[model samples]
Target: MKKNLIMSFVLSTLLVTVLSGCGAASKSTTGTADDTKAPAATTTTKSEKSTTLRIGYQKYGTVNFLKANGELDKALKEKGITIQWTEFPGGPQLLEAMNVGSIDVGHTGEAPPIFAQAAGTPLVYLGHEPASPASEAILIPEKSEIKSVAELKGKKVALNKGSNVHYLLVKQLEKAGLKYEDIQVVFLPPADARAAFEKGSVDAWVIWDPFFSAAETSAKAKILADGKDTVANHEFYLATRNYAENNKETVKIVLDQLAKVDTWSKDHPKELAETLSPQLGIDVPSLERAAKRRAYGIQPIDDALINEQQKIADTFFKLGLIPKEIKVKDAVLPATK
Candidate 1:
């Protein structure tokens, strides 16, 4: 009986040991499964973190329409991405922000980038906006008899130097067979130029956009000449060289969103004007008129575009607006297939 009891105790001890070992093995297997899943979880977290894109834009353009619609922000959010929008007063200011790495992408007219490029600012042309000539013009007061570009030869012409209107003025003068020196050029911001025009301080104003439209309606200014005969007057989408190379995926997203906005602007001109009116503090009627005249599409940056830009650079150089000639091709991003 003593032997049997001892045998029973031994058996009990062995069974307990086996059970504990099995429990530990099961825990080990579970822990390994969890360890394997960690990498995938980490990868997903990294992807989520990369989805935020920063974009910069100015008022008085299709970007405003995009901002008002809010579709882009929603679309990006679904892809685990967020968009941060920043606004500037105009293209020149936006390009300046881009130059300093404050902005990732923005739009500007033909002249601002040329001036920026000549200054050796680090930027790249990502895309082109379709040509819009009617949006920019040289304006004279209603009662003024400045019928031809030549009539303003000796008069002081107000323009934003280094802006697209500057190029327009130069080209128009050249077309009239007059030197840029023949006219007294006054460099003024849009606000100051408007005030000067109202106060009868400026003989003529060469300008663009809502301001041009405003001057035409409110100031009773007559169009001396539109950009039609002289310049392509197309706007450009520019990005910093570093930002574009580092964040191609983000760049593509921004471009795609911009194209969508361009489409919307074309389809809903009146609605766009109403949507933007409150934001810009401009009347809807004027915005509608300006919207009608502007282009609403995107084009890839290519050789033909570059050639057009090169002509602008050459003109600026000849007029001594820029210190040296800049090759537009060198500043353009590589063609995307």
Candidate 2:
């Protein structure tokens, strides 16, 4: 009877041990099932549709008109794409945002992208606005002695560095039979440059519209030389390489709308000024003068435009404005469809 009891106890212990082992295995399987479900939930969250199209733009360009019109939103809404506009003070800042991947598309003057490219920012030229040569100019106070670009020798010339106007000043100086070193170049953005010009701290202010128009009307400034006889200040629409390559269709939509707006602006200067004045905080007449001066021709990128851009890059590099040589063609997108 004692031996039978010992065998029974041993069997009971075996059963308990096996059951404990099976319990642990079951718990392990349950944990794995939980882990598998968690991944699926995460995947679903990540797979949710991304539907925002972010565009970077300056206050002075066609993108501003696009934002004000709301037509781009209407056009893209059907495709599950919504427009998000970011305003930048200038092209360099706009491209800076693009370089950091904060913006998908932007518009800038001819020089900003070159500077951005020299700094290793990956960009592609998507389209361009026809050169509005008269829109940008070198201005002198109405009563100042500086009559011509040649008279600017040894004078304080205020302008924004790395801006399209920078190249304009350089070319204007060369055209006036003066070298860059012959003048005192004071680098300032539009606001500060305008301030300095008003204060008479700078001899001449190199600027663009509606600032140019405002200066002419408000400050009684005279144009020493406009872009007419200088560099072609072709405004460029730019996109990140990744965005341009992946979203050609969306880009095409934007280009089409911009083309329409450009044409409309050309035909209706007073209307464009009326639409822009309240937003720009400038008077209607100044805005009207600016609108009329603008060419309002946005075109697709081509080899000719690329070559012209290369000249700008080369000029900046030669002048030691950009750190290194950059090829503009490296960033040219497939011809706008």
Candidate 3:
């Protein structure tokens, strides 16, 4: 399959990255690639010797808002660091870019990082936004007779593999007293999954916002179950271990600016959707609906959160989605004092 081949290429690229001891790419926000630029050596405390800070972001979340605000850019510029913004289709691909040293830090949901860490990608848990369990859900067609998660057994469900919604699907099934094998899972990206759901090729689709919000507004998809009782569905920010270790000051600057964005976003509820809609290509109403339930305030990774990540890792390994077991703590950076 084309998807399989693409993944194979990504894996091969990662192997070459690790083998060559090559540092991350210094690609600017433009399409240009700068493989010759390695990280600058840290000179002294608070110097943050790095000149360019590469970042990866998906269609949604903290970095996008932060970049748009330009406050982080101002702060980092004071420290002599500029940001390279690279967009990825999803968390897995973003982390793949991270593994290939394409970017330094990126944001993702709960499950992708577990898979990334399991594969031995040298990434560290940086920080997290507050949990928004209502952001993701198991959605059915507008008129489908299927009314509950239990009814989904034996039906085809579509979702992006190794995603936050993947675990949402799993936990929701268990709450319904069903096993992982109870349904047919079609692993597709958000766009393809949306198409499949619209065509009725799949009985239900598991997904997160703003896609979840878009579905409700556009297709009238019914929620069989949201993450509410099933999962935390926290959004996390991650960086390569090397990036975090050598450029701790730069990392702190990024998180600090994120905190500012969170405050402004929380205080301006209606504006959240209005501001993001243009970039996201979704209507303001849907973006508003999705943003309403999401909480703000980015916090450092803690043991309580680490335990939850561990549970996700254990569940994936049990389902044989991952080849081996992993420890969430192993990839975590200690909290900044």
Candidate 4:
């Protein structure tokens, strides 16, 4: 009886030892699984934090307002992203930066993108700026008697080629029942156009923005016609397809911030002018006038807008401004639903 009890106790002890060892092995296996998952979690966290976005803009536009307020940078900083801002003189120059991948996104008037698209640039239109017809016009000296665009025939017309004003000139000529060949086209940038206009080197000058306001105030220029008679004068915001596709969150943040700035500008025109005067080195009143004439808003590039742009492209191609027919819809962002 004593031997049987001792044997039973030994059997029970061995069984308990074997069960405890199995439990410890199971716990070790669980710990190893947890260690394997930890690296994947770390990698996911690092990936979420590794993105940076770059944006490009110009002076005297909605992007400037967004940049000045720092709202975009603030919104992006919350997402563990950084925004790099670059400024250009005009839309053509901005598109130039975009073509070379120096900028991921940019804003420009309707004409620059058409020109770039015609040249086979790989840019996608992300959005459209609110249309403002009064912001663009053809101006002549106040004392001049060139009453109509028809009189511009055989005269040297100063315009920024491939700029928004280029479209204005073309449309105005067509309105007057004249061909583009009827006029002596002199392609001058805004600054040079101003100098030429002031020196009486050009019979007429087509321009936009602070320059238009400056010429109206300082140079006593008379408006031959405004863009209202020609085109809608819409500005476009564009990004590279690769950048926009890869960075959707960043683009949304940017568009949201820009929309906010547009709303703020509409409510506070005088304050906006006061804010921009010193920055642009232009007078407050001039900036104020320009601000009122300028429309500020951000809108997605939809099918309608793309079709309208296509019409402009078609016009340019027919007039030989663009070398070939361009399908504007192809350059719209893929996520443009």
Candidate 5:
């Protein structure tokens, strides 16, 4: 009877062990516990995107307008990226901040990047806006006798050095048969330039809109000559090489956002002006004029465009404006299809 009981107990224990093993196998097949944890970890890794994209912009840039509208911020937020916007009074100052790692991506007129690159900044040209030559010009106070670009020779000319207007001044001087040495170039930011222009200390101010338009509306500044037949005045989107290399998709997204803004602004000039007026602190009329003159489209930097930029760089180097001769192509970030 004792032998019979021992055999019966062993059989019952084997049955329980078998049932537990089957339960564990069923759980594994349905992805419970240990089996379920891996996919969850992978899903989290794929979705938990995180990074900050710092964009540096000048006061009147369209990118700033884009930021104010929150299009870029909204678009980037979905990809687990946040945008940090920093405003600068001028492109040169913006790029100066960039050189010290304070900025990741930014936009500037064609010249600022050239200056920044020549100064050993790791600037990467991502894209460019269509040429907006009519958006910038050499202005004189309406009451001033300086009527043409040629007449300003031997007078004090105010402009931001290493700016788009700087190139305009150079070319305008060449066209007017005046040497750069003939005019006393007063390097000043937009506000100070406006002040000097108003104070009658600076005879002519070379500037870009909406400052260009504001000067005309509020200060009665007259255009000596616009860039229509001179410089291309292409606005450039730039970044550090490091940023462009790591965040390629983010760069593409920024350009895509810019294109959308360009399309909308081109269609709704009045609305664009009204929206930007408060941000720029200029009147709607002035902002409208400025908006109307801007060429609203974004283009990738191509060989021809690179060649154009190279000409600007070479010109600066020849004139002893930039400290060293540099190739614009060296700063360009090649597009990966």
Candidate 6:
């Protein structure tokens, strides 16, 4: 009977050992399964890469107001994007930088884009400001007797070549029954033109404000014609095609901030002038006059707008300003909606 009991105890001890070993192996298998899930969790949620936005702006554009107010910096900070601002004298220079891929986006007058497109620059029109027809004009000496655009014939007219005012001069001369070849177009920048005007060197000056207002206030200047009867006088925002395609969301943010500033400026013209006076180096009254003449609404580029721009392009081509015929819509982006 003692031998029987000893055999039963050995069987029970072996059974316990086998059960414990099975339990440990099962636990090891479960741990291996858990280890396999960690990689998938890592794959599902990856870290986002950082980005940068480089913008080119002119001294007197809406982008300048955006920079001064710090709206763009605040809006883009959370997206891990940095803002780099560079200033140019005018839209042509700004778009020149854009063509070289140095600037991601910029603001320019309408005619600059037309010329840029003619030159085969791959730019995209992002948005535009409403037409401020009276914002630009053709000025003669206040005491001069050139009463009509007709009198500008055979006279030296000072203006920036390929500028928005260039279109104005073309259209106005046409309306006055004068051919472009009738007048000698003098290509000079605003400052040089101003000096020539003061010295009575150029018979007339075609320019925009606050420079226009400054000329009027500082000297005797008279407006022969304003854009009200000639052109839309629209301001455009342009981006390179590559950047627009890659950074649509960042571009949307930029447009949103500009819209906000546009609204604010329209509501508070006096304050806008006060803010811009120091930056533009013009007096408050002149800036105020300019602010009033400015169109403060932002609109997306549409097919109709592209058609209008195409007309400008064709006009420039016919006038021998651009090399060949080009389509404005080819350099345009879809609405940011």
Which segments of model 6 are wrong by more than 4 Å? 1-50, 335-337
Each prediction's total of clashing residue pairs, residues at least 3 apart in sequence or on different chains, is 0, 0, 0, 0, 0, 0
Model 5 score (lDDT)? 0.81
Error of 5 at 227 (Å): 0.5
Best by lDDT: 3
Ranked candidates, highest TM-score first? 3, 5, 2, 6, 4, 1
Supply candidate 2's per-residue lDDT for 335: 61
> What are the runs in model 5 whose C-alpha is more than 4 Å off?
1-50
Residue 154 CA displacement from its true place in model 4, Å: 1.1
Q: Which stretches of candidate 2 lie over 4 Å from their true place?
A: 1-50
Candidate 4's residue-wise lDDT over 32-109, tens digit each?
122111011011131342355546666678877776677777788788776666655567766765665556777889
Pairs clashing in candidate 4?
none
lDDT of 3 by residue, 71-169 (tens): 887898888787777766678877776776677888999999999988888889989998899999999999999978999889999999888899999
TM-score of each: 0.82, 0.83, 0.86, 0.82, 0.84, 0.83
Model 6 lDDT per residue over 301-329, tens place? 88878888999999999989999999786
TM-score of 5: 0.84
Residues 220-290, candidate 2: write the lDDT tens digits.
99988899967888888888877777777888889999988888878888898889887678888898888
Root-mean-square deviation (CA) per prediction: 21.1, 18.0, 6.4, 21.7, 20.4, 23.7
- With a 3 Å backbone cut-off (N, CA, C), the pairs that clash in candidate 3 are none
Please list all clashing residue pairs in model 2, or write none if there are none: none
Give the Cα-based TM-score of candidate 4 against the true structure. Answer: 0.82
Clashes of 1: 0
